[model samples]
Target: MLALRDSTQYAHMTPAHPCDSDDPERRFRPLSPVETCVDTCGLARDSAPYFSQHNKRYGVLTMANGKQATARRLKMADRAQQLQDLHFPGMPEILLWHRNRHDGFITIPRTLPIVMQAVDAQSKGQPAGHTLFCLWARSPDHPVLSIENPSTFAAEAGFIGERAVDTWRRRMKKLRELHCIETKPGASGEFHYVLLHNPNAVMEWMHSVGLVRAELYSRFIERLADVGAFGEIEAVRQLWAQQQAAEAASAAAQTAATVPAAEADATAQANAAPEASAKVQIALPELGANL
Candidate 1:
């Protein structure tokens, strides 16, 4: 058997397997569990190609349709047609939200449900999740949105009773406190304009603040990874680390610059003191001789 090192350069090759070595003693060595998964447990037959010797080193497997490699690039109309055929044949294409024609849809993270649960856990008995969703729905594909009518928003968020608007406002405040949104006072009220934050980033911040439960966080991470979006959080963390390192380096440089100047000033003061002392001694001797 041939071995492929666990590297992106050889990622197209069959999952790393134990290679036949010339050393007889090591020939029977078993493959580690991680390396043996493809051979022993196996991937979905439709999704993974069969390993063969002819193309073992050179061939690349085409991922399944709707997999990460092709899903995003697959035309929206094609995807909708595929879904329609599979689930509801003869469905009118005109009714579908085809990308070429639709205009009023909002993009959202796949992990939003998990985020909603996290928010609800932090602010119990409040429709904070509903309010957050409502805000997203109202947004015009932008992070910032203006709520011109609190009463209408309250109704949309399912807040009822005479104080529905008041309840909605409370949830809105909770969302701001959780760092999911930012608000500023405007003509509408205290939270007339709202700025929505990335749900994944907000979840990360909540996790740091001890607001996210470990189990929920695990699920959230898994969902993000599934959607190939976990990198966004990691990228943010890396950027923050880079900023901190830059700040530390800048501070060190300033301290280094200041120390040299401070030492020079001290040396000048010390040298002047000796000269002043010598001059005083000379004056005293002159005065004595004159006397």
Candidate 2:
């Protein structure tokens, strides 16, 4: 019963449910009852009287035909629900839960539409799941309707639904923690746009989290040099060098401080040996005089 109800929540009914249906006139109508019965009954002399039975149940039927109809409706609803959950779960409620007046069907939520050209440029052998999330995170303005060829992406980075969701969640969390990205509430007050307009913001955040490798950093500097951002790159490089030199100098000073005081101990031993030698000579003279 719960399954049926859940399935019907998103299902498209000819006469939609009271909650979803917009027509105030039909909203008060009572739900129609469903019935079931056996068709054939046979009687023989050996067998007692055969009787046909009718199921007088009032709610929706649960027989084969009814189940099929329910299943079909549920499948469509489930797909729509999945897409909704991925793109626009609860935000910008105005656009997400809108009903089409023409066909009385609910349309899919409008995500930050990614264009095909951008997808073609970025979609290179990455998993569909990763590609989708990456597009959402990196290129929200350019939404990819469909992949031209999904095979390479599926083969290389086959991130499925759960893994993809987790990965994107972690990325967003990191971005927020570093203050590289900010979420602005949509007009509807339910949806948000993840903004990444500042390139340096992300790079700095990545550096803080140790996400940028040395080689990659060097490459980034080179690219900056190609343009006119060399001054900024050089400043960063100088800071790194200063830090490294300071650490090295501190380590050298610590090493010198740890050396043992061997020279002072050796000098003390030499002075004590001379005094002992004199004492031995004096004792020898005293013994000769007594004899």
Best by lDDT: 1
The weakest ten consecutive residues by lDDT in model 1 span 45-54
What residue pairs clash in candidate 1, if any at all? Answer: none
Off by over 4 Å in 1: 1-80, 94-99, 242-291
Show where candidate 2 strays beyond 4 Å.
Answer: 1-159, 162-167, 185-191, 208-211, 231-291
* Candidate 1 local distance difference test against the native: 0.70
TM-score list, all predictions: 0.59, 0.24
lDDT against the true structure, per candidate, is 0.70, 0.39
Task: Rate residue 154 of model 1 by lDDT.
Answer: 95
Report the lDDT tens digits of candidate 2 across residue range 1-291: 111222353222222132323453332232211111122332211111110111111122122233454576578688987998898777665555444323334221121121112222232343122333443433434322222233333333344463654444443344444444455555422114555423433343354466555444434433332333334433554676799999999999887766545666778899999999999999999999999
